[model samples]
Target chain A: MSDKIDNISVGKKANVFFDGKCVSHSVFFPDGSRKTVGVIMPGAALTFNVGAPELMEITAGECQVRIAGEPDFKTYAAGSSFKVAENGSFEIHAKDEVNYICSFGSD
Target chain B: MSDKIDNISVGKKANVFFDGKCVSHSVFFPDGSRKTVGVIMPGAALTFNVGAPELMEITAGECQVRIAGEPDFKTYAAGSSFKVAENGSFEIHAKDEVNYICSFGSD
Candidate 1:
């Protein structure tokens, strides 16, 4: 993974969720696809609803994640990734913090 | 300003400060200059040290700001902005979360 994403349009406003436990900004690409660059604060576990298939790429920090229908929470650290299906949901916990790039419709 | 900033490269990693009270992503322009899109959470007053001169453009929410050398705090709302000189500092308080685009070196 690269350190930066080049040539994109990003919204000025941010998406703050769970009382700021999760925050993300929308990024738009030339091909019309979109993604979000976000940071999840290490706090109480947070559940995320996936509208489309998503590929969560962790760039820094660590997280324990459990996808819907999955029986266990897996650990993902920097340079690691995981996926969730469309219309699914997941629970994530970060003991410190998690910086991620979330790609939608990644199926 | 427009709802989005186009044709810019942004770092995947974020700049999280004040225990996540202030979070920003760095955006690079083709001209080699850089800016940040950030959110100031509603909580305590936060002081930001300026490296380059910065123009803080408020996109949403509200804030009371006091630039260094200034006597009183000024209120800035959506569609408004404030400037800080290089090497100076400023203190801001947001009763509600403030969403902003900060353009640097705008002198």
Candidate 2:
């Protein structure tokens, strides 16, 4: 929920996904920490596979997320964060353009 | 320099900078490409040291940049891109809150 970050480097090359539904860039910190800042355009639902644990925070707009096995989807908006376990998968639905930051953890 | 990037995962932590002058998150692609997307606030100019070559693109607002020994600073607006040599330094001046995506290259 913090609005400030510092002391990191970025990666070269753009990462495109879902036929252009999402786009993001990588960020690296001095202590080896990393995260991705991106925007998701309004459209259909998206399913994502998690390799490592992740913390997804919505910076703008709103969306609903359904974690695997969850009975109901939870809605999130700007300043909200949700966690996804390693090897877990989640489905996201956004009605409007969504800007977010996904932070991967060591697990 | 592209507006849309996809298929990338993000890191787990936020990268903070310059005593709250900037903040960013990391993004990772399935193919290992990485980048950092961030925002720089308006204030005093700041100098940065580069470990690798960097391509800085302004996504919102505008800023002035001085790459190392450049005689004068250059202004960049949204959709504009600039390059910084590996191991080189650069200075940035944002008149207002400036949103940017910086891509790091392996020289």
Candidate 3:
């Protein structure tokens, strides 16, 4: 993310739901933008249902991801990002404690 | 952070102030606890005047830190944590894009 966009004020708290594989915190900005930054533990797989457009970025570590309708899982590493459409679902297999940021947009 | 603490419901948004070296998002919980997760860019140095006791953890990358009255800065890397007393000030030199979590306690 650009330093300009990151310079905004982050609003109230939000949480990410996962059994034990991942932990995330929601960040809202004064411009009404929101994102979540969290960690995904190693050797775990998780599937999530999305309600809006989501952009998932890997900040640290690596993971294999299978977004809905994909034929096979693909590798994503630090500095990589993928997008999921509204109402889509995605699966993730973590290889390490993966640090990530998920940005949501109305789309 | 443990999975249980990681499972927390992250509350409202907060912003961190820095010229261009770092960006952080504030996280609040229902229990009135708070934290901020952020990134410190490479080769940047910053000093902060803290009002409460703060526990800072390096989740990714590396940094050299000098807490108040500390004779020298210590190098810290991933999974390392340090504490700062209330009303104390600290300086940091980032060697990379350092990801961290700063947890604050009343005392």
Candidate 4:
């Protein structure tokens, strides 16, 4: 792949994918795709349930993630890196509106 | 691997790596490593020479990259993603102080 950075723009669509939120945004693999932005509003959370996942740095605000049977939520801030297991389940919550990018593949 | 982002800090060191700048910062692979910050200063450029390279988003300022005898430089701003070939040589230049992160592996 070219070493050039790819620029992507997300317009004014305040998009959020919640538990069971499976919307195809970009075709990452022949049989899989990714989401541009996943938001967790005040008192909101999401449980992801499939695919090989990769997350970009949290660009703004903060959020909490609970993975597997983890007791406490792991907090993350902007400019932080995150990844997800292919068949794992995790919940994400935010005190305010938070936005992030996620990519997935089915290999 | 855990989906949590690994936190790293570069304490008080204004580090820059130029062509032939090979410094091991983090051990990514058993036999390979990565560099945390690569700065290309005003009127300065770098040519990366080895490894499986993955760059984090440009975090500050701006820079230009020339690859494979390409005529013009690819300008990248903060939050842009970039990757590098395992054995390819490319040149980078900046008009001002620019900083970025690069990760590499032996695989």
lDDT of 4 by residue, A1-107 (tens): 22111222111111213321211112122232334433344556667664565553455568888776678788887666567666777777765545455665443
- List model 2 lDDT by residue over A6-85, tens digit each: 44455543344664466665666667777876666666589999999999989888899998878999999888888898
Error of 2 at B9 (Å): 19
> What is the descending DockQ order?
1, 2, 3, 4
| Better structure of 1 and 3 per lDDT | 1
Give me the displacement of residue B36 in model 2, in angstroms: 10
Best by DockQ: 1
Worst 10 residues of 3 chain A by lDDT: A3-12
lDDT per residue (tens digit) for residues A14-80 in model 1: 8888888888889999999999999998765999998989999999999999999999999999999
Give, for candidate 1 chain B, the lowest lDDT window spanning 10 residues.
Answer: B35-44
**Residues B1-107, model 2: lDDT tens digits:** 54444444455444556644565667665566677777776654788899889998888778999999789999998888888998999999988767777899864
What is the alpha-carbon lDDT of model 2 when measured against the actual structure? Answer: 0.73
Write candidate 1's Cα lDDT for B33-102 as tens digits: 9889999888658999999899999999999999999999999999999999999999999979899999
DockQ winner between candidates 1 and 2: 1
DockQ of 4: 0.01
Assess the local accuracy of residue A59 in candidate 4 as a C-alpha lDDT between 0 and 100.
52
Which of 1 and 3 is the better model by DockQ? 1
Q: Rank the candidates by TM-score, best first.
A: 1, 2, 3, 4
The digit string of per-residue lDDT tens for model 3 on B49-96 reads 899899998887899999999999999998898899999999999897
Those runs of model 3 whose alpha carbons end farther than 4 Å from true positions after fitting are: A1-107, B1-5, B9-14
lDDT of 4 by residue, B1-107 (tens): 22111322121111223321211122122233434443344556666664554554465668887764468789887677566666666777765555455665442
